[model samples]
Structures are given as structure tokens and as C-alpha cells.
Target chain A: MREPVPEKTFIGIPASDGIAIGPAFCYIPAELTIPVCAAGTVDEEMTRFDMACKRARVELQSLYEAIEKRAGKEEASIFEAHQEMLSDPALEGKVRAEVEIGETVEQALVKATKELASLLAGMDNELFAARALDVKDVGHRILRILLGLPDTALSAVTETSIIIAEDLTPSDTASLDPKLTLGFITAQGGLTSHSAILARTLGLPAIVGMGAGLLEKVPSGTSIILDGRTGEMIFAPGGETIARYKQIKAKRESHLLSLKAAVEKDAHTANGRRVEVTANVGEAASARDAMEHGAEGIGLLRTEFLYLEDTQPPSEEKQYHIYREIFAVMSGRPVIVRTLDIGGDKPPSYFPFPNEMNPFLGWRAIRISLDEPELFKTQLRAILRAAVGHHARIMFPMVSDLDELRRAREIVEVVKRGLEVASVEFAGDVPVGIMVETPAAAVLVDVLAEASDFFSLGTNDLTQYTMAVDRGNAKVSGLFQPLHPAVLRLIRQTIDAGHAKGKWVGMCGELAGMTKAIPILLGFGLDEFSMNPRAIPEAKYLIGKLTDEKARDIAGQAMSFGTAAEIETYMKGVLALL
Target chain B: MAEATIQVKHKIGLHARPASLFVQTANKFSSKIKVRNLTAKVDFVDAKSIIMVLTLGVMKDHEVLIQTDGVDADTALGALTSLIKNNFGET
Candidate 1:
């Protein structure tokens, strides 16, 4: 077979592993169309719409059944959600009006999709927006896979993942097996898409927005590399690239394995300064996972989950019951409770809120609580009521100034007095604290740290805000370096500020959990760490082996480094001494 | 409309898993068809695609999509409405 002078292909950074080879197929989503009536009988259109809805319902049921068979009975519920959508009085009924106007099946589906998308998009709920994406995704996947030509395999290649036409839906993202599948690549996605974030959090490497026609060129099992860090893609790379990649990959693998293998008992610094490794948990499942991973306790139990999950506010009694369950399991380990951190990217359904063009910089966290004292009070009352007998601390998220800090403390004090008057045996004087996530909070750390019993730097937000890099934006993601001198300075400053006031400082961000960062945290004199449960034992092990004196030296050297890579190498060198 | 026959060059053929995909695409417009062959004509398959094209027993070199209609009739016919006209082509 004669091939044209093979166009020299560009290579990407290798993020995931494995090989693939199959007929390259690409899926380009057709823009949806909804009918704007010209002239038609409403009754006829209604009948046709009904027929289409029925057909959609039937298709959805079969899809659900198929998903159930492949996965399990529990997962079948996602499809049931689709079925419910079909019967939604507002959703299906809205489209039914247009269908009653005699829209074709194709037109009906498009109209229905846009209607639902617009409604879901408009909602203040983050979960609603997520669900809307799922609605479009599951429906789109089923429709496309059903109609696609040349039949490609949704069935995965062993050890290699199935890339997609676009980013995967939330349900699909959740269902993937981490080891057997590397993760998906898509032609249309931002770094913040649920799939992208989930993949990153799971430590599965992924790159998005490869543009269209990816599936057409990159055949499955063809020895391709997905470089998530640099956003590079290489196909049929030569031995040099492969060998260079293998060395880096092997070192990284050994690094991860070393974390697990390094697992010892209690955490301590080089000078025998003890550090407690805890997990930041939102659910019972994650709490259980934290205990499994050797977490000392839950650092921040976000009580806002009650508000996020339901159609209305969770009554104080319900909130109390949840707290009792969570704290009881801790077997007396401290559970620091953070009040409602609503608004911005995470919004409540019932709240009348604004969609900020730049959500991270918008009215969010404690700003919302300060502005709406009543909502804040109701939530505070609920937290205080629930945390009566539990190891609890009243923590606030996003406190920028002294007034906000002073006002929040006053509210907590008032609530405690109220609880005491009611003759309730409660943990009335819960340690009140604020997440030092913003630059303003870090800048005002000395004053704010004095008012609170403890400080916890949410480095995820701090890194994003300080660098002015929207981590959600791939173009600037490189700039979201936690090791940036500015960020490092704030972290060091926040820790010092907290300790100067005799307040213990901790971190519950991704930065706190990085294996290399353990030494730096030790140097910073952080007393507690909160991360995913899976990372606890590893963090504990890393911290256990470190000496405070050695860590202090490493941090000093790292801050003076030129690049993040250099800082990592410097930190790794320090860890070697252990 | 004029009809042309093409082979399935993509190897896996038309009927099995690929049929539904072909159908989903075919259903994109308002068109009608009775896909058949030199041997036997299949009548009244759901024009909505998700099932029709897949039933063609479409394998490599198989021919199908005998008839079609609607506004973009010729363009649709030239572009796609006629499916018995591909070889999954080699570049």
C-alpha cells in the first residue's frame, strides 16, 4: 500500500499510558433545531409531539435497561432520571406545546433539548447545571451512537480508554474504572468540565479541546500519548520519545508507589514535631474512606451539603441528626464544621443569586453570609443545633476583612448564648475559624488569626486567586502554580500569623496533599493537613519520615528556585535525606 | 433520484452495530426510503434511522438506500440519502 509522504506529526506530552489501533471515527455534534411556527394546527402538532415524547420515553427506558445490565441495579437510576425528564410537567409539557404545533420528530427533540438546556442553565444550582449537562449528554450519546455510521466500539480496549466526540457526561465520568482506563480525550472541553476536574482529582491525566476530527486521525491502540500538563498529543511516536517518556513515567510511578510503601504510623517532623493528617470530607462515604486511609479526623465538615441536596432548606433537626451521625463515627476525633459557603460557582437553588461573569471573584462565601444575615443566621442556628454533642468548630469560608471576621464571630457568639438559654447540652463554644483562601485574608492574617482559634489555608483558591489564573482556563492553568513565590509567601505568612497568635494553622487544599509539599508544610509549621482520604496514609508516611530541621532547610531552598520543576526536585532531594 | 452502489471500506460493514449510527444520521432530515438490494427489497423500515440502516446486513462491499425524498432531495441523495454508495474509502 502506497502512502503519501506522511505529514510529519506533532507529538504531545505523555500523560496516560497504553496503545490503541482501530478505524478512526469522529463524532461531530449536529446543532440542535427547534421549530418557530409558521402556520399549523395546534392539535395536530400536539399529537405529533406526544408521539415523539412517547418514542423518546421508550428509547430512554431501553437505554436505562442497557445501562443497568452493563453496570448494576443501583446505576440504572440515572436512566430513570431521563424517564422522569420525559414526564416532567414543565419540561416535556413546554416542548409539547411546540410539538402540538406539528414539529417533526427531529425538530421536536431539538426544541426539547434547547428548552431544557436553557432552563437548567438559568438555575442557580450547580448541581442543576451539572444535571442539565447530563441530560444533554446521555440523550446526545444515545442518539449519536444510535445513528453513527461505521459502528465504532463503545466497548473499551483493554487498559486504554475510549475518547469521545466531546467531553463525557457526568454519569459517564463517574462510571469509569481508573486503572483499566486512563481517561477520555475530547474535541470540546474546558479544564473545568466535570470530566476534566474529576480526572484531575483522580490523578488520571487528560487533555481536552483537541479540536474536531481527532477520532478520524488517531486510531485506537496506535501508541498515542496524552500530555495533560503541556496539552500535547503524539501519535505513533518514535522510540526516543517513548524511551524518554518511560523514564519519567517510571520515576513518577515509583514516586506514587513509594508514597504507599512509605506508610508508617504516627506523623512527626524531623525534630519530633507532631503533625496530624486528617481528611476534608463532605459525605459519609468519604468519611469512611478517610478512616480507611488513616485520617486522624475530618478537618472541615461542610454543613452546606444539606442545602445543596434538597429542594428546600434542611430543618435544624435534620442538620443535627447528620452532625450526630458524622461526629459519633469519629469516635471523638475533632470535626471542624464550616458554615454555609454558598454563592459564586456553588449556589443554592432557593437563593436569588447572580451568575457572576467571573465567579471566583464574585460575591461568594462569607460575603453572601454577611449580606444576607437571615440566611446565615438560619444556617448557623442549624449547625449549632446539630453539633450539640459533637467535636465541632464553627468555621467560616472567605473572610477578607476584620469587619467580616468581627461580624461572623459576633453571630457565632449570639447563637451560642441562645443555645445556652434553651437549656440545651451542646458544644456551645465551638472553635470559630475562617478559611484563609483569599489574598486579602492572607494579607490581614495577623489580625484575623488573633480573633480565631485556628487557621486553615485553602490553597486551591489561594493559588488561583493570587496567581490571577483561572485554573478553569487551560490557557492560564500553567500560571496556577502554588509554588509561585507570591503564593509560597502567603502560605508561610498565614502559618506564621496563625502561630504568632497561638492559633494552630492547617491546610485543606490540594497543595497540602502533594507528596513533595509535605516537607514544605513541615517547614511552614502547619499543625494539621486535610485532603482526600486516599492520600492520608501517604501524607502521614511522608510527614512521619521528615525532620522539621531538614524540612525548614528544604523550604528555604525551594523558595529560591526558578521553576516549579526545580522546586519539586529540590523537595525530592530533601525527602531523600529521610 | 439516481442511485449508486458503494462498498463498505471500513471493514466492519453496515448492518450490525454501525447500522444504528447510520440510521441516527439518516434521521437528521425529513426523508423517506425503502432500502433494498438486487436480491430482495425491504419495505417500511423506520425512516428514523436508529434501526433501519442497521437491518441492511451491511458488510464490506454491501449496497443499500435504494430510494429517498424531501427538499434537499438531490443534495441529500448525492451526499447521503443513498448509503449503498460508500467503500469506507482508503486515503
Candidate 2:
């Protein structure tokens, strides 16, 4: 007799960084399929296909109209494109051709849809690559119609647990409850997939591309240990592995507790150079979490969340109340409120934007705000009003040129004038800042520095735009490199530009939280670093260890590199020395 | 067959709403319309297929050859040329 070998471990790509030990919550989205059946007569199958197409069109139309009413015109346009894809003659012709060859209606539709999706997926461009998702979305609508199945519900994740799935679509990612989701392990996806990006945005541990058949091999409710930073997974761990993971988790928790105890003190480098540590929060509730994690104040308070999942735009009073609530929680600490910075791939279900080939480089952020002054003024007024009794500042996203910044300032002036005329009490002199997220802005940092009160380098968009890599596209996701020499050089240049003009600069992007980038950022004389709440203590700990002189030398050496890989390898060398 | 080589004047080239509008216009004429993206030097694709038209990956300043044959060849060719010249209604 021979003993059976246990399958206890798996390796996957590290999509988000962290560690988690939780009960596995295997979420299987209803597979796209049709009942097994023989090929019907050609006319009958075509009629069935046509009926499904019509139903899908109606569903997509309602979706478009619904999204347009509240979220705005840009978000609603996605459904319009989906509707167009449904009525595409090429797709219909292919499905009909398949039916003529004696295939069932379901089989022909699935085959045709998949072929188009794969074709788009195979393209090198991000726009075409994104189109693949839309194709699959339309395909699933048709498939769901044929299968008579309801939509998969991800909203009911009420308990904290790790999610294990084959893959998650963008819609599934959107529905994920960050408060309840501990982490995610998917069998298929790259670092830039929607699921991965969602994990990062929500500050959850995740590993993707873990290989197929994970769902079948690993049962639900199984105890699992996922090390997202290391991309390792342990299933049904033995006594020693469990003990080791528990010990590590305990040590990490205690370290965080100690860091939280020291929350009131300002962070300074070994050489006594002080830097502000803040948190980037999405909602009013997150202000408490940020304080708990030792954040001095809110650095980037995203106001866009109030605009989503609603039937209409949040009224000024509603927005004012919410902002006041967040301000009350902060207790006079500075909260830099960012206005609705939506467009491109980040649109909600409701806005309408003209179809553009390269959305990332198209109308978005302050551009959209400038175009719609009423919408922009409402947000500015709310923020200005909130600052009346609290420490608050206004920061605009994606200010690509001097003209855009000047125009934004003009609007602020108008809003201030309106407030004064009405005798409304508000913080009129609250500093105005613009996010240098694009190369054009980065290049014009010195000029922008003179006009603006301060600067915050949005490293996420800066990295993507500088590298020309769409972070949402998995195929080129790896190229969304923040450590590239060009990105580092740009940061260094922006910091210098800000300092030379006597303007303080801060960073409130994913790069600010990355441990690997901290040393260089610290060396670059960055005045502030704001990030997710959970990453604060670790960043503070690392900052406490490095001398300003050492960090500057390392940053200087890093800029001389020719490629991202070389810089990465050198960084690892520097980390080892530290 | 009637044909004309036109430079796509739209700032974003022949994609998105422009591509959709181009395909919709081509479908209106009673002619078998085909297009070849000059930069990529690819084979002709059915001008009426929005999906296929997007596959060309044409950009602003790229040249494209539109060919039409049948009863409304001249009309179709003339309309497409004007569409390009007008920058697909883009300012």
C-alpha cells in the first residue's frame, strides 16, 4: 500500500501586496452556456439568434438610458457601444454562417463571439484589447438570454473571506465590497486585470494567474494562507505552517499597533528631515480608518464615490453635509478634496463621452470639469464651504497645461466671489493645487509651481502616461513600471521644480505606498507621502530607518540607469544593504 | 469601380465614433465598398463592417484608399471623400 501525496501549495503572480489567512470563499460565476441540443433547422436557429439579439439590444438600451440619467453621458456610452457591437453585421454574418453549417444556435453564437473577442485580445493596442472585454460582455448577455439565467450577484459578500474564482469581469470587480473581501485568488488574470486593479485600489491582498482547475481542486470553506507579496498559497496547511503563519501575522499586527500608538508624532528621517504622512481615502468613513492607521490628515479625499451608484448627482447640500462629516472626523486636520476626476476607463454607469480612440489622452479630469462649469462649480463650492470650519484644500487632477491651471483658478475665483456675494461663510484663502499626472504637466512643473500653491505628483497616471502603458490592459500591465528611470527622473525633476519655487510637493499615488520606492522618494526631498491607510505604519517605519543623505545618494544613482530592469535590480541591491 | 485616396483628417484618425460613422455611411450606398489602410499596407476589408474597419488601426495623417463598385459607386466614393475632408464632423 502507498500513501497519497497531499496537494498543499500553489504559486501565482503577485497582483497586490500583503498577507492573509482566511477561510476560502470560492465564488463561481455562472458559466456561459446553453443546453445540449441537436442542430435545429437553419431558419429556426437563426430566428432564435435574432430574438436573443433583440432582447440583448433592449437590455443594453435601458442600461444606457439608466446610466445616462444620473452618472452622466460618458458612462452611459459604454452600453451604446455594446448595443452597436450586438448589431454588428460582421458578427451576425459569422453566426449565421456557423448556423448554416449545421451548428446549434447557441454553439454558433458562442463560437462567433469568442472568435471576435480573441481577435481583439490578440491586438497589440490597448484600445483594441479593451474592446475584447466589451465583446465578451455582449456575448455573455446573449448567452444569459439563451440560458435563462439571472445576473451573478457579488453584492452579498457580507463576511470577510478570501475570494477564489476563475476570473472576475469588470462588473464583478465593481460590485466587490472592499470591507468584506479579505483578498482574492484567481486562476486566470494578469496584474493589470480589472480584478487586480480593484484589489490594489481597495488595498486587498490578491494573486492572479494561478492556473486553471483551481476551483475544482480546492473546495469552499477550506483554510488557506495567501502571501500576496510573495505570490504563494498554502491549502489546508499542516501544524508547523499554520504556527509559522500565525506567528508572522501576530508580529505584523503588534508592529502596526505600536505604530498606531505613535500616530500623533510627525515622521522624520534619521537625519531629522521631517515629512508629512497622510492617507488617500475614497469615502467619508475612511477618514476614521486613516486616523486609526496613524495618518496625520487626509491627503487625497476622492469625491467621485458620491457621484456613483446614484440615480442623480449628489445635490450641493448633500455633498456639503458629507464633506462636513468627513471634516468633523478629521478634527481640523487638512483634507485635500479632489473634485470629480472621472472619464476614460474610469467612467461610472451614467456619463456620456464621445467615443475616442485613445481615451487616456482624451478629455478627462479637469478637462471635463472645465467643460461643465456648473458641475465643477457645485463641487468647488461644496469643498470651499466644507473648509469654513476645517483645514481643507482643493486639488485638481490631470492639469496638463498652464492654461488649464489658470482656467481652473479662474473658476475658483468665481466660486469665491459667489460665496462672498451671498455672505456664505467659507475658507476663501484655502490653497489651490494641481496634480502633475501627465508628462506635459511634469515638463512644465517649474511654471506650474509658480502659479499653484503646491503640487502632488499622481504617480499612477504619471507612470502610465510616461510609459504609454494602459494599466487596465493585462497584456502590457507589466510595462506600467513606476521604477523606470524616466518616471524616477520625472519625480525628481518635479520635486526640484516645486522646491525651487518655494512650493511644497507631495505624492498621493500607489507609488507613495510602495516600500521599494520609498527610499528614492525620501531622498528626493518629497515633503509629503500619502497612500492607503494600511501601508502608513510600514512606510513610517522605513522612513525612520533611512538617513536623508543616503536616500539622496541612492536616488541620484537610480536616475543614471538606462532601463527599468536595471533600476529594479539596483533597487534590490540597495534594499539588501538597508 | 470608383475609388479615391483620402487622408483621414479627424484628430483621432479613423476609429471610435468616426469609424462608426464611416461604416454607417458606406452601408447606405448600393455598392460593395472596401477600404485599405495605406500605412499598414493591409488587404482590403469590407467597409461596412465596423469591427473590421476598427481593425485597420488607422490614425490621423494616415492615408486610406476607399473603393466602391455598383450602381452608387460614384455617390459612395464622393461621400467618403467629403467625410474625410470634413474631419468626420470633428472641430
Candidate 3:
């Protein structure tokens, strides 16, 4: 019996989003060329070399200036050396001396540059040795000018293709034209690497850190599917797989058109039950974008970003102006402002937050806010001041107990009293909310809902705390499932309790943005769905397709499942139907 | 005639920009400057030529002798020695 053809699917770190299907363009490093020519007049050859050098000089200077503008001075300095190499008389004289002999201009330039490059390459100092590449680059530029050849490399990508390379340096990634290049599949790089960042900026699908051996295993010109979503590189994919990818790509393209149309439309169910799809903005700039993307309101304006970059906390006036600017753009639309949920991953260096072995479970969010009442009062006063003529609401993060909620509410009253005494003409009776992230808070939602105006389910932290799995820790990340039975139970209980007390519940977490989790979330009677601005259109599209009854049924069915896998698999089937 | 022995203190040694900077400095004076790689025991070459200077493969900790033969030879020697000692301002 013959062995079946082995599957050729390679796994890599997904660096950018999107699905790309194209022929592989193997990036072979360009080699310096020198064509042998019959001896022309020595003066003619000399003049040609000089003209080429002059042009090369101008080009290198322009390149330096352009690099300085794009990547800054440090990167531009590399081309400065190239420009100086143009002025190197020893190199130029050797070429002219060769031209003085029988050799043509191209031959002389190549010979002189190669000799110098080889000398540099043969050196023991690794830094000096790398100069060989710089010498070769200068030589290639000048030779290409003389040879009447187009600058290749990036421009060489004539047809639509995926770039398969051992690794791409910042320079290589910078040279790629997004129009011609379909995507990037490099053998080495991380998600945060420059190659990945550049690819993302250009909207090119990218997968990195596939290991260098991947280049040798897959030859150039082979049809491959680079799924950046799943970080899979499938070589010579079967007909079904190709057809499926084509369908997905086509659907995505049309989906964009549909989303653009839906941008101005209300996000609602087929039965006409309106779902308020809002944005989780970080700054005034992002708040404007949220409004443009048809966010009914700002769902979760994380206030931590204001204090993150600065050494000192922002003044009340500074904070008030920022909040006012963001709220002004919303134009009476509701904006839920979450208080500074700093500490854990986002500990500002200036803030003397004690380092803890288990920060996520330790003092963070409301714990810090309650301890530092002065900081809390300043933020609250700013929010109250900005709330004038705007539908503004304040929410506290990591509220685990009724005392924490009451203490935060008391501070809000103190700040409001101060603002009133100053006759600051601010909004009174601003509704206060709390994030039900801790399991204790979720369980006591009925009691807390009475004290709180609303509840925003921070499912990300809720899952982390509930599962006792540090989501940041990769080893146990698989266990940190938002859809796990335990997390789902908490979410269901919180929503029920909030509604029972006549308060609306909203979710502003990774789960809220997930299309797969929408059916269950909508069924749980979630009043508001908040997420990244980019996810609003799709969220609206999916929400419009779902009915209240079907969503409830899906949620009810999901709750019956004992494990997250069961719910996930069931959702996959339901998603396929949709 | 003026001569001075200097060590290549630049972290990257006499490569590219540093070498270009050295050559530019050498060309500022009317002095005919020549450099020899004492570490490699190579013959002295024109210090004003970047390619010849690079060819010497002068690296970090490698000693070199800069000799000048002109009216401003002493000034050239002082400037070149300081440039090398200062690591071409890279460090």
C-alpha cells in the first residue's frame, strides 16, 4: 500500500489579519551583475561612469532625505554612508583606472566594488564585515544606473503574490508595495516585530515565525493560502479548501459593502428589537471615530489611557476638557466612562504601585481608586463637570463587594458636593455603574444592582478571576474560556439580577465582540453591546440577523451545556446556519 | 612632518560612516595624510581615501599610525587623533 500524500499545512504566528491566496514569490536576494562589453572609447566609458556616479549621488541623497522623513534620522544615516561611498575617490579611481584599460564602465564598476566588498566581508570584526552589504548596495545602485536597469527587489513583484522569505528586515518590509504584494509569510518574526507591524499597517495578510526550514520545504510559484486569522499556511491546498477560501474572501469583500450601508442603519434584530451597539473608546479622537462608525453611544471609555503616558495625574480641568470634547461629539448620546482601572498590566512608572506576584488578583482597579481617594475624587469631579449637557455615566472596575461600590459612590457624592459648592454648573444625578468582573460581585448582582445604576460585564477579567487562570499566562490560557459553563452562569446570573432590579446590563469585553458569542449574549437580555470601533459594523450586521426568540433559545441551549467545548461546537453549527 | 599613533576607539571600528568622517576630516587640511594598521602590520595608505582606509580593516582596539606631510601636518595629527579617541561621536 502506498502512503497518502502528506498534508503540507505549516503553522506560524498570525501577525496580521485577513485571508490571502496567491502564488508564492520566493525572495532570492538580488545579486550584483556585471556584463562583459567590448572596449569602447576610454573617455566615453569614463564619462558614463561619472554620470552614473552623479546620478547615484543624487539618488542616495534623496533616499536619505526620504528615509529621514519616513523612518527618522537614525535609519537615514545608513544611506549617508552610501552617499559618502559615492565620494570615495579610491573606489572611483579604481573604476576609472579599469576603464582607462580595455574594460567597459559596468565591468570596471563591478570589479572595483566587488574587490572592496570582499575585503570588508573577509574581515574578523562582524560590524566591519557587514559593510560588505553596504558597499554592494552602493555598487548595485550605480551599476543599475549605468546598465539602464530598473531597481528590482520590491518592484520586481510584477504579479499578485505572497512573499515567502527566510526573514524580512525592516528595510525589506519598507520596500514592499501593498498594491502588488498580496501578503507576507516569513520564516522568522513575532507579532510585535517590525515586519508584522508594517504588514498590518499596509493591510497585507502576514504570518511570521514559521521557522527557516519552511522556505526550503515549499518551492516558489506554488499556490498557497495564507490565512492570517488562523496563522495557517496551506501549500497546494485541495480544491475544496481553495473553493472555501475563495468564498470566504468574496463574502468578506461584499460584507464590507454591506457594513458600509449598515453604518447609518440601526443595529437591531429582525423582530425590530433595537440593540444599542456602542464603541469602547480610549480617547477623544477614538470617541469621534466611534460616532462616525454609528456607535449609538460610547459604551466603555477606559480612563486609564489618560494617566498611562504621563508622569503625574491629569488636572481636573485637563481631564474635564478631554471628557467634554469626547462627550460633545456624541451630541447627547450616552457615554459610559469607566474610572481609571490602572495597575496589573498598565502600571504607570510614576505611580508607586507595589509590585505583586499576583497583580490581577491583588490590589488593582477599584482597590487602588478607593485607597487613593484624592485621585478618585479628581477624576469623579472632572466627569461630573464634563457631564454638563451630556448623557454621561461613571462606572467603577473590579468592584467585588457592596462596600467598594458604596465607597466609590460616596466619593462621587463628595466630588459632586465640592463641584456644587464651587458653583461649577455640572450635571447632577449622573448614573453610576460598576463592572461585575469578580465572581463575588456577579453572585451578589441583585444586591449591588440596587445601589448601582447599571452593570457592565467585564467578561475578560471575569473569566480570568472565575477560572483562576491568568489569561496573560500562556500555559493556562486554554483554560481561560469566556464561554466556559462557570463564566456563562455568572453572566446569565448578573444579567437576570440587574434586570430584576430594573437596571440594564451591558458587556464590554472580548466576548461581547465575538460573533459566535452574540446569540448567547443577545439571548441573555444584554441591554448594550460595546466593543472596538472596528467591530461595530460587523456586530450590527450579526445583531440585525438575530431574532430575540432565536437568541434566547440559543442562550438557553448554551446554558444547559456542562463544558465550554460543547457550547463552542454548538455555536459553530449555528454560525454555519447563519 | 607630524605623526601620531591612535587606537580605533569607535565601537564599529573604521567602517562606513566613521571611515567617511575620518576621510572628510583628513581632506579638510592641505596635509598629505597616510594611515597604517599596526595590528595587521599593513603598509600605510592615503588617509583621505575612504576605500583605502576601509581596506585596512581597522577594527576596535586595533592601533594605527597617522602621518602627515604638509604645512598643517601638526593640526591634522591633532584633529585625527581626537576624532578616533572620540569614537566618531557614535558612542
Residue A436 local lDDT, model 1? 91
Scored by lDDT, model 1 comes in at 0.65
In model 2, how many backbone clashes occur? 11
lDDT of 2 by residue, A336-374 (tens): 988788876666556777888888888888999999899
Better of 2 and 3 by lDDT: 3
lDDT digits (tens) for residues B1-91 of candidate 1? 4444444434565532344345444555566544553323434344343222333344554545445666655554555533423322211
Which residue segments of model 2 deviate by more than 4 Å? A1-264, A344-351, B1-91
Error at B45, model 2, angstroms: 52
Residue-level lDDT for A297 in candidate 3: 94
True contacts kept of each: 0.00, 0.33, 0.63
CAPRI category for model 2: incorrect
lDDT by residue for model 3 over A1-578, one digit each (tens)? Answer: 98644547999999998899989988876665666559789898888888998998887777677656765675667777777778787788889889887899888888998988898778765556656756777887888889787656577788989999877755466577767788999886677555686677566899999987887877888889999989999998878899999999888878778888778897888799888999999888788878878799988999886786455788888899889989998999999999999876668757886778877778789999999999899899889889988999999999989988898898888888887788888899799999889999999999897689999999999998899998778998999999999999999999999999999899999898898899899999898999998888988988888899999999999889999999999999999998
DockQ of 1: 0.01
Off by over 4 Å in 3: A1-248, A251-264, A283-296, A308-310, A324-333, A343-364, A400-404, A464-481, A532-538, B1-91
- How far does residue A195 in candidate 2 sit from its true spot (Å)? 23
Top candidate on DockQ is 3
Task: Name model 1 segments beyond 4 Å from true.
Answer: A1-264, A562-565, A572-578, B1-91
For the record, the alpha-carbon RMSD of candidate 3 to the native fold, in angstroms, is 10.7
Q: Pick the candidate with the highest lDDT.
A: 3
- What is the Cα-based lDDT of residue A294 in candidate 1? 74
Name the 10 consecutive residues with the lowest summed lDDT in model 3 chain A: A125-134
